[model samples]
Target: MKLAMKYIILYVNDFDKTMNFYKEILGLPVKMQHDTYVEFDTGATTLSINTRESIKEIIGLEMPASSVASQTFELGFVVEDVVATIEMLRGLDVPIYKEPVTKPWGQTVAYVTDPDGHYIEICSAME
Candidate 1:
């Protein structure tokens, strides 16, 4: 038997805010939504935003808050232009965690945070 990853569920404090952020800002189309869960089509995989309390029930333990101020992981996107993407997200008033800069590996990258504190890194290695 082979195991395949289908989806990644992110614990969010406010489902609506997180959903809208992904839908409007990241441009991920919504696949479905319920009273406690929202799923977005991220091209290759499904990204889910669920209420923290509900996530706790699913994990059978107390879930920690995933806020912009306390992010643990980053959601990454490959873009054509990291600078332009940063400008667009900044125009949307999204908080910038890091300005666009070239990494030691020679990849242009930038970082931003979602409403619930998920870091999103926009990188372009096309150069």
Candidate 2:
């Protein structure tokens, strides 16, 4: 099947805080928004945030507990300068999971946790 669009929908407990993190902090442009949902334009894919209450209404089930330690996936972004990005995020008081460090594979990377405790990685472009 040919996929035309892609999106990662994160069910968050605090919708406004999560939305502001991606919009104001990360500088992602808003593609769509509502009282319960928001979609940000992230290059080829969209990063969407939906309230957990809305998800419960749609699916008729409660969402499971969310924790950064329990998350098995991360949202990754390729930046021109990992060090500068991490510093800027730090200045804004964003939680830094890992300081910028060069990996054995030659990529510089750092980790940050979003408002909802989702792991986000900033890294240099892969060679």
The candidate that wins on lDDT is 2
lDDT of 2 by residue, 88-113 (tens): 99999999999999999999999999
- Point out where model 1 deviates above 4 Å: 57-60, 65-70, 125-127
Model 1 misses residue 96 by how many Å? 0.5
Candidate 2 wrongly placed segments (more than 4 Å): 1-5, 65-69
Give candidate 2's error at residue 72 in angstroms. 1.2
lDDT of 1 by residue, 1-127 (tens): 9987788888888877877788988898889988778888886778888888987787677887654445556788898889999999999999998999997889998999888767889999655
- Highest TM-score: which candidate? 2
Query: What global local distance difference test value does model 2 have?
Result: 0.89
TM-score of 2: 0.91
Instruction: Give candidate 1's TM-score.
Output: 0.84
What TM-score would every model get versus the actual structure? Answer: 0.84, 0.91
Itemize residue pairs with steric clashes in candidate 2. Answer: none
